[model samples]
Target: MNNGWFYTAEFRDGRFTQIQWQRSGQPPQTTTLTFSSTNGQGQPIYTGAFQAATAVTLVDLSGGNVQPGSQVSVEVEEWGWARGNCRR
Candidate 1:
């Protein structure tokens, strides 16, 4: 099952947030994800909400502003997992 188990969200300012997940056949969930690190531009990244769904994963971004023409980098983390059997 491919499940799209891993996700990486890139910021416009060249910073990225990544998440790893697993499912145990339970239900959908929504949680707040905070970035404890800064981007390549030396600015603190913002916090966002992560929602695990069947059709597609959703990320609601809040805070942090980026400037133009900057390079981006990604930081991956094995945060946690989601449990669900949602058909949709």
Candidate 2:
């Protein structure tokens, strides 16, 4: 089977957030995933909730403000399989 995933990030109100991951066609039966964020120091910052859906939204709560040239990145991964991995 061909597994696929998508992710996106956005900044609003000086906070970093994710829009959601939309599946290509249909949703998965057993969808298990996790979300996390960190700072430039590679420290664990924020962790998001998991759900069963084609997409998910993430939020960064590092208590830092996001500027226009702020260097922020996000990562998404799929559990039990090594297919869905995103960074931005």
Candidate 3:
């Protein structure tokens, strides 16, 4: 079943980045974060920030899944920043 767990990061500078649905109870995985802008038509314009940016780390915590009573938490951290198209 899809746990529908996702990680999202919003920069104070107005950037929204989201990671795909990740399964719980699994080892941590490295995912790339990205930013984009909107065109005049109001469509998302994506750009690659793999070079200038650092890596994003995601951690899964055991919760509600182990014992009868428990909780799960997701952690996220930003490695670095990338310069290019700003978020709109």
Candidate 4:
């Protein structure tokens, strides 16, 4: 069983790259973490929601089509676990 107290995740071009976390009461840390390397490709529908996510596919919202440097940043608010995307 793999486990860690993860607080944040980072990605580059749709690839799972790193995580910010802490091990119990220890100091929080930012460390390299990758649970997948397939670029999150494959079937879209996942039958299991409670199960850990095996993949994530990032897309380009640039209208033309998904291409290099086309990914955009999305701001999410977890305050009270209920909020919408906050764009500036």
- What Cα-based lDDT does every candidate model obtain? 0.37, 0.39, 0.32, 0.32
Give the count of colliding residue pairs in each prediction. 3, 1, 3, 0
Tens-digit lDDT track of model 1 for 1-88: 2344433333433333433333566444433345555546455543444454333222222224333333223222343333222111
TM-score of each: 0.24, 0.39, 0.29, 0.30
For model 3, the superposed segments whose C-alpha errors exceed 4 Å read 1-5, 17-21, 36-40, 47-88
In TM-score terms, which candidate is top?
2
lDDT of 3 by residue, 1-88 (tens): 1233333322234333443333477643333545344446443333333223533332212211222222222233242322222122
RMSD values for the candidates in order, in angstroms, are 11.0, 7.3, 14.9, 10.1
Candidate 4 residue spans exceeding 4 A from truth: 1-4, 34-88
lDDT of 1 at 28: 40
- Candidate 4 is scored at a TM of 0.30
Provide the lDDT at 47 for model 4.
Answer: 16
**Model 2 stretches astray by more than 4 angstroms:** 1-3, 27-44, 52-73, 76-88
Full ranking by TM-score: 2, 4, 3, 1
For model 4, the local distance difference test gives 0.32
Model 2 C-alpha lDDT per residue in residues 1-88, reported as the tens digit of each score: 1245544444445444434445678563322323355557543343343363333323343335443343333333443222222242
lDDT of 4 by residue, 1-88 (tens): 0243333444456343544444687677544443322224331111111113332222223332334454332211221111112122
Candidate 1 backbone collisions, by pair: 14-72, 26-84, 27-84
Better of 2 and 3 by TM-score: 2
